[model samples]
Target: MSEEPTTPKELSVRSLTGLILSAGLAVVGLFILPVFRSFGLAFRPAFWLVLAIEAVALAGVVISVLTLHRQRTLD
Candidate 1:
């Protein structure tokens, strides 16, 4: 048996949800990091590096959302 393809509506909803969640998490992390700082680790270079990684992840999520929207519209 073969798996059925997902409809554009389903894909758009799922992708949009994922993008929002990812962006939310990144924003929350920015706010929470300063609240739990231990000996200024949150202000250190490594901390900023991790934040940069999260920013990149957020960008990827945004791209994915745009791609899904385009695909859904094309369908």
Candidate 2:
């Protein structure tokens, strides 16, 4: 059977939530790489700045997951 083509207008809430979740994961993954290489710089202000941003990304991931759970229960 042929799958129906998905248009922007047809996108479901679950798909959008998944997209947000994926984006948050990617951000966290990319941000974490610098931490491993910047051990010497860990005491600097820049390291803490980056860590704060990473924490925000992590929060986003958590929120998106909760949103998915709510959607699943509603369905």
Candidate 3:
């Protein structure tokens, strides 16, 4: 019996950018945030910094999804 080969799809530029941004944010949230929290710095400027990063990451993901959807519809 012969098996068919599977091909991988390439990510668009926007998709790749969003993936990278989101992954970087995830790393910050997982590592940096906890460190700040452990040091009892959550009430300081660190809170605002983390909040801004989260908001930007969320916006990037949303924009990426919307653009990808529009691109697909246009195609």
Q: Give the winner by TM-score.
A: 3
Better of 1 and 3 by TM-score: 3
Task: Give lDDT tens digits, candidate 2, residues 40-63.
Answer: 554456556666766676776666
> Candidate 3 at residue 1, lDDT?
100
TM-score for every candidate vs. truth?
0.50, 0.43, 0.53
lDDT per model vs. reference: 0.68, 0.60, 0.68
TM accuracy, model 2? 0.43
Lowest summed lDDT across 10 adjacent residues in model 3 is found at 66-75
Decreasing lDDT order of the candidates: 3, 1, 2
RMSD of each: 8.9, 8.5, 7.0
Kindly provide the TM-score of model 3 when superposed on the true structure, using C-alpha atoms.
0.53
- Candidate 1: regions farther than 4 A off: 1-11, 39-42, 70-75
